[model samples]
Target: MKLIIAVVQDKDSNRLSKHLVKKGYRATKLASTGGFLKEGNTTFLIGVKDDEINDVLDIIQENCRSREQTVSPVSVMGGNVDSYVPYPIEVEVGGATVFVLQVEQFHQL
Candidate 1:
């Protein structure tokens, strides 16, 4: 057995959820936030057999697409507030950070 952990943008979560269900894969969705951009993200915990790993990966790859986005920096409330100027920078977002791991045990209660 294997566990597939996929962290994807909120924009693509719905679409990816649909695809995963249509392919008969079960997943647990959790609301999350990104560290860099502080944007909403969805983390999916999927458990599947070893042979199904590639199919789940392909589904994630097709659904979550990385694209450019302009984001303004968040200002911190500190001494440098007077000199701090927030600037919008182009960043790459909307992609899945996937991690696959081997499962030593599996149980359903």
Candidate 2:
């Protein structure tokens, strides 16, 4: 068995979950917060057979897409504190960070 931990942006969470369910994959979603962007995120816990790892990954890849976003620099993230920059900078966002782990045993009641 394999445990798939996928942390995705909040924007894609709903869509991803729906897609997974439509494909007959069970997933549990948890609300989470991201440290870098200090934004809301969703963590998905998916348990599946070893052979289904690739299928899950493909679904995640197709649903979670990275895109450019403009945001004002914040002082906490090592931005210029002394001066104020009115213009917002472009940064890449909205991607999923996934980890696959081998499960020694899995049982459902």
Candidate 3:
């Protein structure tokens, strides 16, 4: 058995969960936060047989996509002033970080 841990953006969580359930794969979703962006995220825990690993991965790939975004730097402008930039910069966002682990045992009651 394998444990698939997928941490996806909050916006994509609903769609991903729906797709997983539609494909007859059980998943547990938890509220989480991203380390880099410090944004809201959703963590999914799925325990599946070895043969089904690819299927789970396919669903995640289809649902999670990375793109560019804009953000502003955390610095003062106009010298020794407590003012920030009026506009934000662009950066990359919207992706999934996944991890697959071997499970020694799995039981459901």
Residue lDDT tens for model 1, 1-109: 9999899988889999999999999999998997623489989999999999999999998998688787665533246667554776677767888999999999999
Q: What lDDT does candidate 2 reach at residue 9? A: 88
**Which scores higher on lDDT, 1 or 3?**
1
The true-versus-predicted C-alpha distance at residue 62 of model 3, in Å, is 0.6
Question: Model 1: number of clashes?
Answer: 0
- Quote the positional error of residue 40 for candidate 1 in Å: 0.6
Candidate 3 local distance difference test against the native: 0.85
Report the C-alpha lDDT of model 3 over 1-109, residue by residue, as the tens digit. 9999998988888999999999999999988886833489999999999999999999998887787666665532557455667777666667888999999989987
Question: What's the TM-score of every candidate structure?
Answer: 0.74, 0.75, 0.75
lDDT of 2 at 18: 93
What local lDDT score does residue 33 receive in model 1, on the 0 to 100 scale? 95
Q: What is the lDDT of residue 29 in candidate 2?
A: 95
lDDT of each: 0.86, 0.86, 0.85
